[model samples]
Target: MEDQFFELMCEKSSSESANTSGRTEEFLDSSANTVDISENEEERDKMTNFLQVIESYTDQEFRRNFRLNSSTARMLIDRYNTSSFYTNKEHGGLPKVGASKEIYILLSYMANTNTFREIANLFNMSKSSAWRILRRVVEWLLSIGHEYIQWPSASKVQDNMRKFKAMKNIPNFVGCIDCSHINIKAPVSNKHAYFKRKQFYSPQLQVVVDADKMFIDVFAGEPGSLHDSRILRRSSIYEKATDDVESKFPFNSFLLGDTAYGNSQGLISAFRENGFLTPA
Candidate 1:
């Protein structure tokens, strides 16, 4: 009776082992069949994330966050797509973040001057990714900046003459010139050079704007400590003015400016009375 019981137990164990082996083989077969679906799943996930980035915001929210209307932002994206430098390619080797989100990130950075970590937190991306997006977008924008901001041609300047004089009986006026300091953190190199008379660190941004407030030219990267006159002298516009004001601009056309600027053949400053210029 004992020998018969031991043989029965051995047979039961062998049957259970075969059943377990068969189950393992079935699971492997199922896994192999499903392996190709992972790529599709990844693509779906990317689309979901992209939609989530844009779908929640209205046009008003987009404008508030980016300082540009939704229409303008869309136009910029289209321009970037067609641009030879930025065309539908990811040359930076970074993972794909949707184009809309990338534009939003750049505009957010520019509009609010937010720090990189803050942008990363708001946009749900890594800090390094945010920085990479900003760097590439800024470089691309700089490359195309000349197309947007340029000196008006001789004919265009002549056309705007009447409109400019309408401001304050200032005839033959072309535009206004001014410089303002933009605050910045102390740089690792040349910290003292960036320190301004106002006891802050900054770089001076000199701008030439038409009476209609459209930018005609801009020069930046000058140390805040430099005088406005020194900055003006260093500008390419000033070089052009000094070279031959008559050939470059409309006959007798002059730029309007405050006392901070000097009186040149092409640039004119409002006359000062006593301590300051009159509001009139």
Candidate 2:
């Protein structure tokens, strides 16, 4: 009888040990699942907050931050959506960013000097993703730039001339030409060529604007160390004007430029004062 009791106790202890092991495994699994769910909720909340912050901005604030009004931003988003480049995935990988968000990211990059990492964090994306979106958006805008920026038609030139005459009492004035310096990092080749008088490395952008301050022509990629006259001579507009002034300056109109541009067939500059001019 004592031997039978000892065997029964051993069996009972074995059963209890197996049950405890099973309960421990179940608890560990439940804890792991809880951690996963918590992480997912946190990510969702972050996205929600990011979107809400943007949506709550006023019109002025939106323009200040994005460099464009909300309506114009929406229009760009719609336009981007119509292109083949607009997609939510690449071969069924992680979902791609939407058009609206991509545009905002591009504009933010343009309107500020924020680093890619900062921009990515603000938009809830990775640095590489921000770079990719910028490349796509910039290429799209460049592809369509010619449609918006071009020499005025003959009639349009005449209209612009009239506006210039009325505004500044200058006859046959069609547009204003000027140069601006854009800061850039030192290039690996010919670093000195990009260093300007302002003690920084940069590139120069030459633009022609009509009376309405709308860009009619843009020429860039010249080193900042170069003079305005040299940049102008290197431009296609100069080549065309020098070849056939009538082709570019219809109605005998001319562009007003600063002294840096000197004088040309289709351009006029202010006379330098030497402090020896007699009253005429």
Candidate 3:
């Protein structure tokens, strides 16, 4: 996924260089005037159809399709609006699509698991347009979203003790560790590495979530065929756990995990008993 985003960014940079005149503020303003009134109405109706579909969804339906509740989705859009490239009026290039709506389009691509063509049809945009919107929004999210996430500090670990104990009688536990596969298009080269035993091609996404189910850390880009333990060992978070964090808060503070992650010094795994696993 990261590589794909970089490739898209490179493509965008090249395209921008070739179309300097088309992107000028005067050209953008006059381009709208060049279209006939009927064409303008048609474009408006297309956007309206897109909005109508979004509005018709109930709360659960909306969350199912977009993978975020309405409020969170709106909040993300508000954050995106802070970016100079995403704001509508001040930008010159193309007539801007809705900041909120374009975000919804990208989320639908990610959450609803649709192809670019399907999303384009749903949003009343061209296939290339949908792809461009997704690439841009993803770039922005990757840049800004990580600022809000931090690993549990020593005090934070201490504070969550009671809540962790109440949930499962576990003491001093800070977070859960797990890995899942994110499906992706087959790469042009080295296609064999991503194929898993389960007969799927994907990239492994390792995540650590605190008791509240918020992601504290994430590591991606490993091939799906790799073992969980190997991915964890290769991740920077694993290095932090062993080299830095373990000595400072050694007692009762550990990460909970499954058998796939193996027994490690700073991590705990469930015990295997008669094919069932007991909690660490």
Candidate maximizing TM-score:
2
TM-score, predicted candidate 3 vs. hidden true structure? 0.76
Tens digit per residue, CA lDDT, model 1, 1-280: 1011011101112333243234323322332343332222222111225336665679888667666677777766787666664544555685566666777777776778776656666776666567667655655555554545567788878766888777677789888889888776665456698899899877677777766666667676667899998988987678878897876577689888898777886898868678665676
lDDT string, candidate 3, 93-148, tens digits: 65668888788887776676676556666787666577657756765665553444
TM-score of every candidate: 0.75, 0.79, 0.76
Which is superior by TM-score, 1 or 2? 2
lDDT of 3 at 239: 81
Better of 1 and 2 by lDDT: 2
Return the candidate ranking by lDDT, descending.
2, 3, 1
Tens-digit lDDT track for model 2 on 1-280? 1011011101112333243234323322333333222222223212425556877899888878766677777777898888876776653376567788887887777778666656766887656567667766755555455545667888889999989989988899889999888776665556698899999876677778888777677676677999999989987668768898887898889999998878888999977678976754
**Poorest stretch of ten by lDDT in candidate 3:** 2-11
Q: Find the candidate with the highest lDDT and give its number.
A: 2
**How far is 147's C-alpha from truth in model 2 (Å)?**
1.1
Instruction: Kindly report which residue stretches of model 1 are placed more than 4 angstroms away from their true locations once superposed.
Output: 1-59, 84-95, 275-280
**Local distance difference test, per candidate?**
0.64, 0.68, 0.64
Which regions in candidate 2 have their CA more than 4 angstroms from the true location? Answer: 1-48, 90-92, 276-280
